[model samples]
Target: MQPANLLLLTIVCVLVAYGVGYARSRSLAMPLGGIRHLKSLPFYYGARAALWCGLPALFVLGLWVAFQGKVIQTLVIGSLPQEMIPGNEGEASLLLSKISNVASGALPPSFVEAPIVDASERLQALREQSRFYMSALVVSVAVLAGFLGWVRIRPKVNARVQVESILKWVFFACAALAILTTLGIIFSVAFETVRFFDKIPITEFIFGSQWSPQTAMRADQVASQGAFGMIPLFTGTLLISAIAMFVAVPVGLLSAIYLSEYANKKVRGVVKPLLEMLAGIPTVVYGFFAALTVAPFISDLAASIGIEASSQSALAAGGVMGIMIIPFVSSLSDDVINAVPQTLRDGSLALGATQSETMKKVIFPAALPGIMGGILLAVSRAIGETMIVVMAAGLAANLTANPLETVTTVTVQIVTLLTGDQEFDSAKTLAAFALGAMLFLSTLLLNVVALKIVRKYREQYD
Candidate 1:
């Protein structure tokens, strides 16, 4: 069946289940009056009933769907004539795929064998019928449970308090899910990084200068010795991030100040979204602009001054990345600046401080924590950015601070390491995970520090 049809069926089943529960509960509670009329809301009873009835059935449906193809293929193979099974595993797998397609009416030619075709037809029909019956049973049970719960409603139940407690638990569960997902990702990265460290000593990976990752194809072949040192990639990331911050922070902060303190309402309305429009531009577009236009322009400018410049320089990539991050910084800073009580700005103005003076001394100081938070967010964006650096910075990992030279970033290295034909267990491939772990940890640390600063400042204001 099509994905859309499956989705529609599932939704219809859930709604039917909810309706049944609602009706059953109403029927049971008809005789009850006053406080005894309801211990909980009718909707709450329906929801609880639906959860119990639908969750298990849906889980079963999901598991069955996942395993059904494999089970069917195994059964079909066992029943097939031994000679019909292809000699090679790959060929056998292909034949099985063709058989499945034929059964599903996706193949042009109909199968010639009567028994095989009949069995395939019967199996498909059975699966569909089973699913339909399961859905109906699940919905019926849900409604029955909801009706029973509704009949049990009474004045003494304190349903409001119960509902509030249930909501708190639900929120807690959602938070746990988010935290667990993060932890799972971290652990997966850590495991692969550990494997990488096993093959190349941690010291070599960390301190080596060159980064040629090519390995010998054969025992007799001369191998271009791989340099696992990560210093160059790390340095490139830092350099680019620094350039981006330099450009974005000042421009974003100044624009935010103008918007919050000086701009007329009409200007604010037109300019804020226009500034935000920069964020919506795709990174690929920025990459081309950096590579084709900005880098060439910089090289020409440098040549005029008698300094050699790379056609693809770090300066071009970093500068464009900075421009990309400006809106993120400005929009966030604007919100935090505006959030600083207007009364504070007014109070500073009333003391005869000029607008600029008030902004620098009073409003800016008051909003410093928030501004820092925005800067930290921008830093994270700069570090994680991939496309601009990959296109304009070139893939040579150079450990240099000179923006005029080409430098590759951690993200670029990670991309190059895992692309094309790759063995997941190899050190080169696993190195990508190590880089990911480091990136995740660094961003997490920055976010934590920013949050603490913001919280402390918030407490002081309160």
Candidate 2:
């Protein structure tokens, strides 16, 4: 059976187990006079039966799905003739791809070697056998476990305790999985970054002014020597992010203040949704808007004022990005401001403070932590944005602070470097990981700064 079909079947079994368990518990309870005589309720018994019927079967299914491909590939590779075996990981991967294509009927049978055809047949047979065994075992285990759970249900058995214990471990496993995934990403990026640093000097990467990532494939080739300087990329990223923040912070904050403190229910209802609609617009649409409208207007306006501006300037990208992130800051700030204790507002009013004065002293301070958090999130969003920048700001890694000059960000360069089919062993490809590591560190620093800001100003309410 297909995994999806098996999953559906397992769910049906679990539901049937729940019904059976519930009925059996009630039957036992009636013999004992009433459900009050049982140690726990019928709901607990049903839930326990369902958990038994589902959890073990699901665990086995997950393990099988996770490891089946690797096991099959290992077996297939081992079965290959000694001369037919690949010498390297890359070649092995290619051979496996071909085998998979042939097995799936994508490749013509007449075009391949006889050994490959045989291997493809073996792969298909093994897969069918594996699926057959998996389905039978999973179904048998589910039925047996369900029966055992139902039989074990007694007046003295504590089903609630067992179910809660299992759920607690499941939650812990989920949390651990997330942590492990993050660690895996960090380690993978770090390894590639180290490789990148080995190819290019650390000093050159960090302090060099130019940003060219093109490396010559051969020593005789007259291609760019590929300056791995990150300064230009960092400069462009910060310049655009600063422009975005300049446009976003004050406007978003003020709008939030108005909405929370002065705007009536009707006004807030109409204005807030309209403002948030900016967020719903796709970044690609914003990219088109930036490229088609904003960039040209800025260039024309700059030319009219006799101030030179690039047709694709950081101002266009940053301004549109600012508009994109405004709802993020406004919505989060509005929520935090409204969440401030009503008792504190009333106390300030009783002290003859004006509404504005109350907001300045009491509510804003209370909400400042969450506001800072929102702003940090917006800044991160601005930094990570690529589509708008790619369309509006040209991807020349120019080391200038001028928003009117065309420039590119670290993220843009990372995307450019990894855009095509390229070997990972190249410094050019590894540079993407190096850039990613830097971006990750920049975000981490922002989080640290936000925490410090919150700690310095956080208010406590009893």
Candidate 3:
């Protein structure tokens, strides 16, 4: 069984044991000579038993699974014929893999050898035996624990409280798992970035303006030195995000206003979902629409107006990105607007202010915090968006503000850096992580600020 499956099985076994214990205890404590329980429910006792049996066993199972592969490989290699072992670790691993495949009935003739074959067979048998023993042990422990828990149960036992406590722990574990996963990703990126910094100075990477990432093909081959200035990328991301915000904020806010204040049920029912549909459209589709439809149209329009325009102008990409963020901004703003207490609106109307006057003077100001929060979120999304920029925005990292010129964003640069042939240890690859780190920090900061503003505004409303 896969380790994940085994782990799941172990958990199920524990829960079953707990149920069994709980049921048995309740049955024994029955008032009459019938099956009715006198004390806690049967399931509670069983669950308790299951928890005791399953947790320890599963913990051991996880630890063993983590270390088993390396330990087993080492043991197998030590047992192999000395002559059959390859000189390099990589080659030896390949040989070991071939031997394993052969034992599993997938061995190729080129790697087939009598000693290796024998070793593979022995390893397979050992693994199978170990699995069988472990399974038996798990089952035995679960049953034993369940039986013991059953013996301990009484009419006075507070099964509900115990169950609640167990559930809380379970929830805590799930939350920890999620947090650990995020931490793991961060650390993985950070370590790789550190490795990259070792090859290239931080100063050069951060401040360099020219971003050509080509490396020398051979020791003697002439190659253009790669430039890693991130200004252009940052500029592109900001520019596109600005354009998107410009498109989204006003439209989204107005939509929110119409829906919350003016629109009747019939209009709202039709419009809200339609606006949400914008969010469901795949970004790649938006990318192509920008490239094929919007880009050309805008370029032609600009030319007719006596302005120079690139086929893949930032304006086009930014405009499309703005369209993408509109739903996000509107949906969030709508909720915020709706959340504003009706008392305030009623009070404004009672005071002789017109609907528009109340919305402009009282409601909009009150909902401004949430509206800004939504806008900040949209900015983050626009900054991080990759596929649209990759397709619609040109690869040129021009650090210019002219919307007519093409530009690239950080996400696009990261994609290009890691794509095609790449040496993982090189400056180019590492730059991707640094850029990612910066992006992550920036978004995180924005979210924090936005959340803080929302919280303060919420307090005011309350």
Candidate 4:
């Protein structure tokens, strides 16, 4: 059976186990007096059975899936003749990719040698065998464990403790997985960034003005000893993000305040959803709007004012990005504002404060931390944005602060560097990881500052 189909069958088996256990518990209880006399609830007995039926089967299925590819590849490679064996990891990967394409019929068998064709056939047979064994083993384990659990269900059993303990471990495992994944990403990027610095100096990367990253692939071609200064990318990022925050913060915060405090229910109901609809629109759509409409408008405006501006400029990208993030700030701030104690508002009003005075003195201070959090989210969204920046602000890593000029961000450069199949050993490819590391650090710094502000306000308010 296919793994997906097997998964469905396993779920069905678990449900069946639950039903059987529940029925058994109820029968045992009925002969005595009621479920109150039992050690634990019938629901806990059913849950314990379900956990037993699902957990071991799922664990076996996971292990099989994880190791199946490596085992199959080893078998196929081992079966090949001495002459056909790959010498290195890269060669092995390429050979396996070709074999996969041929097996999948993307490449004709006639195009490759007889040895590869034999290996592909071997690959297919091994995969089929693995799948058959995996399905049978998983199903058998599920059924056996389920039967044991159902048989164990009795009036004297305390299933609740066992079920709760299992659930706590599961939740802890999930949390650990999340933390491990994050650490893995950080360490991977850090290692690659170290490799990048081995080729390119950290001083140049951090402080130099030029931003080219090209390198000669062959001796026949001219070598451009590429510049890897990241100052321009970071400068562009800050410039655009500042513009976006300037546009988003005041407008979004004020809208939130109005929706939460000043606006009547009918107006709030109508306008709030309309305002939040801005967030649901795709970033690419915003990109198109910035490129087609906002860029041209800004250029014409600049020209009419006797100032020169590029058609594809940071101003256009940043402005439209601000519009896109307005809903994020507005919605979050609105919720936070509403969460401020109603007693605070009532006391302020009863003391003869005006509506605006009450909002300013009582509610807004209490909601400051949450409002800052919303704005920080908007800032992060602006910093990480790529599509709108790509479409509206052309990707030139120029070291200039002019909002009217073309520039790029760290994210845009990372995407450009890592877009195609490239050799990771090259400094050109490894530079993406360096830029990503720097971006990560920059964001972490931003979060630290925001957290400090949040804690200060929270202490006062809480």
Superior by lDDT: candidate 1 or candidate 2: 2
> For residues 119-149, could you state the per-residue lDDT of candidate 4 as single tens digits?
8998888888999999999999999999999
Which candidate do you rate higher for TM-score, 1 or 4?
4
Enumerate clash totals for all models, in the order shown.
6, 0, 11, 0
Give the residue spans of candidate 1 off by over 4 A. 1-8, 23-36, 57-169, 216-225, 455-459
TM-score each candidate: 0.77, 0.88, 0.78, 0.90
Candidate order, lDDT descending: 2, 4, 3, 1
Q: What Cα-based lDDT does every candidate model obtain? A: 0.77, 0.91, 0.81, 0.90
Measured by TM-score, the strongest candidate is 4
List the candidate 3 regions with Cα displacement exceeding 4 Å.
3-22, 32-43, 49-156, 178-183, 216-224, 303-306, 420-422, 456-459
Residue-level lDDT of model 1, residues 1-462, one tens digit each, is 433455455556566656665565565567675324766666665555454445554555566566766776666666677767666655656666666666788764454565456546655765676567555654455445444545544444544565567668768978997999888987889988898888888888778776767785666543354667878888999999999899999999999999988999999999999999999999999999999999999999999999999998889999999999999999999998888887888898899999889989988888898888879978999999999998888998887989999999999989999886466766778888878877888889989988888887763554
**Please, what are the lDDT tens digits per residue for candidate 3 over residues 1-462?**
556667777777776676667566656766655435444566676677777777667767766666777777777777887887677654766677777788788866456777887778778877887677666666566566656666677666777578779889989998999999999989988888788778777887778766666675666543354667777788888998888888988998899899989999999999999999999999999999999999999999999999999999889999999899889988998998888899999999999999999999988898898888888878888888998888888898998999989999989989988885455656777889988987888899999998998888753655
* lDDT at 34, model 2: 92
At residue 341, give the lDDT of candidate 2: 85
Please report, as a residue range, the 10-residue window in candidate 3 with the lowest summed lDDT: 31-40
Clashes of 2: 0
Cα deviation of 332, candidate 3, in Å = 1.3
TM-score for candidate 3, residues paired by index: 0.78
